[model samples]
Target: MSRTTPAPWRREPGLVGRTVEAFLSPLQDAYLRDTPSAVARLAQLRRGAGKAPEEVPELYGLTGTEGLYAQGPFADEKTEQRATVAVHTAVTLYALHQQSQRSRRMHRTGYELGAAVRMLMPSGEIDEPLRRRFVRVGTATSEAIRADRLRELVLLLRRQEVPLDYAFLADQLAQVQVPQLAPRVRQQWGRGFHAWRPPKATDSDGGGSKGTDTSRDAG
Candidate 1:
């Protein structure tokens, strides 16, 4: 009898998966990716209560990074791993759209063209929401991400780690022209997508880690 091999996720390593294109459009660059100067200019759009303004970069990068497939020929292991970033990024965009929609606030047109994405096993056998939609939409599942059997994918990404903040997002957007409102794409692959890890245990110690022994040595 053949023994089953361990699942990739079960082992210890950084999060890994494919970055499926959450949304695609003919006209690209609808939203502006925030820049240092641009962010300052948008003083009108203030950050939440005590948040730093820099956290919110150019809106263009944020919205434009959608539908970016990480490099080609995902047959190789390294290639697929690197491409996972796009998957993570897609999750960011998805969260942004969801939260925006959940709040019922009109930041963009009806949740900013909310796109969808989810983590999944490598085999792509997982019956995840995104997979379900993919079938209806007829998008290829070659790079489609499905739910992981282990931890939540979004949890791995740093809260402030916006994939769009980097130049890669712009480059990807530049390549493809996402026509305005072409059922245009997007996702929760943005900052603050998941609930932050609970407050860490306080290091406030009443005494030193090395304690002194007052008791005298036995005679």
Candidate 2:
């Protein structure tokens, strides 16, 4: 949403990522503009979080995800399922993130899950408990468990007023569902966590100083 950043669609390279950006960007824009219809749509999507499509049939057409299946059938049903779930998870979490806030943008361009979580620490120091929570999220073996843990993390980010890149999150969610790709996804998360540093501070005289070092072990 920042004028300096590229649009979400342009930042995402995969189909699932593109789909998620397409689906949520407009709704986010409208909600920020105080459109009642978009706000109501976001609420409806939020309710579908961690829920099956059958359980929330009303959310079927609202995701703006027809592009996923429009091209043709996926190579396999599991791939298709993973893509759908990824889109749903990212969009729903975004809706939850956008809830109750109108001034700040919840769908930031480059804030991934790890960097966003890093912002939750006091003075940019990593807290052991938060680090453990993030570990559990990455180690989750089942989609159900992963979704539940992600739900908790999303809530934490919301409380701290941190924004995330839903496009990248969607891509990670989808890739993690694959056997070979899971490790890469986990590694990226770890890199993001350890590599995150607070923005440099500008001194009164316009000199810049680095932020506190946060690369210490969580243990």
**Top of the candidates by TM-score:** 2
The candidate 2 region of ten consecutive residues with least summed lDDT is 210-219
Tens-place lDDT digits, model 1, residues 114-156 = 1112222222234465344433322222222222210132222
RMSD of each predicted structure: 18.8, 6.8
Give the range of the ten consecutive residues with the poorest summed lDDT in model 1: 105-114
TM-score per prediction, in order, is 0.19, 0.84
Whole-model lDDT values for every prediction: 0.25, 0.73
Q: What global local distance difference test value does model 1 have?
A: 0.25
Error of 1 at 184 (Å): 30
TM-score of 2: 0.84
lDDT of 2 at 57: 78
Superposition error at 9 for model 1 (Å): 6.0
In model 1, what is the error at residue 216, expressed in angstroms?
A: 48
lDDT of 2: 0.73
